[model samples]
Target: MAESENGATQPQQPQQAPKMNVLAQFVRDLSFENILSQKGAGGDVQPDVQVQVNLDAKKRSVENQYEVVLKLKVDSKSKSNGAQLFLLELDYVGVFNIENVPEDQLHPFLLIECPRMLFPFARRIVSDMSRDGGFPPLNLEMIDFLALYRAEIQRRQAATQAEASNAPTQ
Candidate 1:
């Protein structure tokens, strides 16, 4: 503690700037399936591709380290024949070191920023996997993680409100 000229102690100052880092990233799990015969898969028919993205975070320590995982699930089916074309599941994990982020802001940072950092690698993997599986490369569109997070929160809030309303009145 430091004392002022009049003997009042000065508040401690933060020792460092806000810091966020991607310590490491890796593919935790990857699965790809090609559902049609290699020769004529989706040749005549247009395939409908659906992609789902999910993000998860786990604190690594009492300090400011965390593990963020981005999961991508994709399915492609031929609309005309009702046949499956391809399916993919990927779990990409990143070890991050984050510090000085406020509690309220931390959740967004973990879900959005961390996953954004990991998306390119994960996307490349998906594209390569699809091409290697004898199909065209699957180019995933950019994800709006913040929107997804907000939407999920809104959904949970709506569910909670519905549950409260449905409860027996006191």
Candidate 2:
């Protein structure tokens, strides 16, 4: 046991970082609504879908856990006459337990890995909703979340640069 000149006690050994662990992970909530197609579509409907998806992730806590929400909307229409076929929205959220991950680097795991993990389940729901809405068993294609996120980042960066350039020289 030794004390420094400032009268502060020092440990004989260096302290180690906290150990991380995974606690729990599962789908918290899911919803698929075929509101329009369920009510208005008729037989002999040959439809084309306009699909859109959005992904978001957040660290629910610092204790190695997070939440990611995958949202998709499909607006299907008859190709021949441009008549409305069906409008469906699928919003699914999944909770993930990520442990031992550094704070600064957790973003990629959220924007990239978490969404990637949740896509398949979300895709299945999309297809099933279309089938359950009186159409054939739909086969929704896979999505590239990394590409989407990169594109968004690029767009934002360009906009910021442009704004900075356009700002009055002061």
Local distance difference test scores for all models? 0.89, 0.71
Alpha-carbon shift of residue 163 in model 2 (angstroms): 2.1
TM-score of 1: 0.87
Model 1, 14-69: lDDT tens per residue? 56766898888998999887887653544566779999998899998657889999
- Residues 43-126 of candidate 2 have per-residue lDDT tens digits of 675778888888777777555667777778788778877877767776678777775666786776677777777777777776
Candidate 2 overall Cα lDDT vs. reference?
0.71
Clashing pairs in 2: none
lDDT of 2 at 38: 62
Pairs of residues at least 3 apart in sequence or in different chains that clash in candidate 1: none
Model 2 clashes, total count: 0
Q: Evaluate residue 96 in candidate 2 and report its C-alpha lDDT on the 0 to 100 scale.
A: 76
